[model samples]
Target: MGYLTCKFVRPDKQLFEGKCASMTLVTYSGELGVLPGHASEICALGDGVVRIKRLDEDGGDERDVVVSGGYAEICNDVVVIIADHARAADDIDAETVRRTHDKAQAKRDALPEGDHQRAYYENKMAWCDLLLEKAGAQTASE
Candidate 1:
């Protein structure tokens, strides 16, 4: 019935900015959905998908964005998402991610049990999996 002014951004660039009918974003606690008149709040972001429903009068217009880490603030029907990383599902090129994931997996495996860098590679691999899944290019995880 109303609209929300939404801005989805990362340090490098602004990914999405516009008005939408509704939006769902992942928080450290869980997925939270916001409509035009949502109560103002702030939440820590988590690695997951964001779903946005557009204000098309015809309806059924929607978009999904994969994001990892950051914060979201809502006030007065305006939602601002400052993400550490954000990418539209449609833009992912799964073939490239698959290759890099394999490399990251190899690097992670090479690390000793106590290696701190192992976590970085592990996170990368996990992110690759998420990207593959969100892009609908996922092959069953082995």
Candidate 2:
């Protein structure tokens, strides 16, 4: 079977670089699936989980990461994800995420309805929720 050269990078460093059989990720338009021969295109990424399936000598290996936001580019059977913020599900600190989520939720609740600051806090809480969900899913899969 054909494979894709996948690279995932964050502002601080490259998080992943390898070959994968397939990848699924969230985009601004919606969820997108990329295979070995996917058409070349560029898409704005959304906050969600990115799943990669890799094939090795032994068998298939699946990995997941939480991406806050960014862009994805595909070309010549190569896929690159440049994320604003990303961390492997296994690397996430669940306790830290929970604390941040609680703080953001509390701040949003204290603000008056329709306040602009509330939106910011709401977004932060949502991001934390996504991370927490991904972390839980990873743990359950183990």
Candidate 3:
């Protein structure tokens, strides 16, 4: 099978780099699958899971990463993911994320009845949902 070079980089360091048979990136709009010789494009990523399938690896070798938000660029036989925040499945702390989700939920619940609070809650809920979804997918796939 043909492989395409894939790399994910954040501000701190180079997150990952390798050749893969297929790669999928999660954007606020939806998930996009990329393969060798795929047309180039750019997508706005949301907080969610980035799934990857290595070309020569076995089924058990699939991997996933969680990113807060970022830009995904597909070009020149390469997939470049630059995220605002990111962590691999192994790096995810479910307890920490759960706590954060709880705290956000609490803040949302305690807010006075108003548009401002409502918007805040909505945003918080969105973030929590993304975190939970990514976490769940990561655990299930790994």
* TM-score of every candidate relative to the true structure: 0.86, 0.80, 0.71
| lDDT at position 77, candidate 1 | 98
Residue pairs in clash, model 1 = none
lDDT of 2 at 139: 80
Instruction: Pull out the clashing pairs in model 2.
Output: none
lDDT of 2 at 109: 94
Q: Give me the runs in candidate 2 sitting further than 4 Å from their true place.
A: 104-120
Mind giving the per-residue lDDT tens digits that candidate 1 earns over 116-140?
9999998898889888887774234
State the lDDT of candidate 2 residue by residue for 1-142, as single tens digits: 7999999999999999988889998898789999988999999999888889887752688888889889999999999999998988878899999999999999899999988999899888888888888888778977
Model 2 Cα displacement at 54 (Å)? 1.1
lDDT of 3 by residue, 1-142 (tens): 5678888988898888988888888899888888888899999988778888876654527678878788989998889889887778777677787788788788877878774876866776676566677777767976
Winner on lDDT (2 vs 3) = 2
Which window of 10 residues has the lowest lDDT sum in candidate 1? 133-142
Instruction: Evaluate all candidate structures by whole-model CA lDDT and list the values in order.
Output: 0.89, 0.89, 0.80
Ranking of predictions according to TM-score: 1, 2, 3
For model 3, the superposed segments whose C-alpha errors exceed 4 Å read: 57-60, 100-129, 137-142
The TM-score measured for candidate 2 stands at 0.80
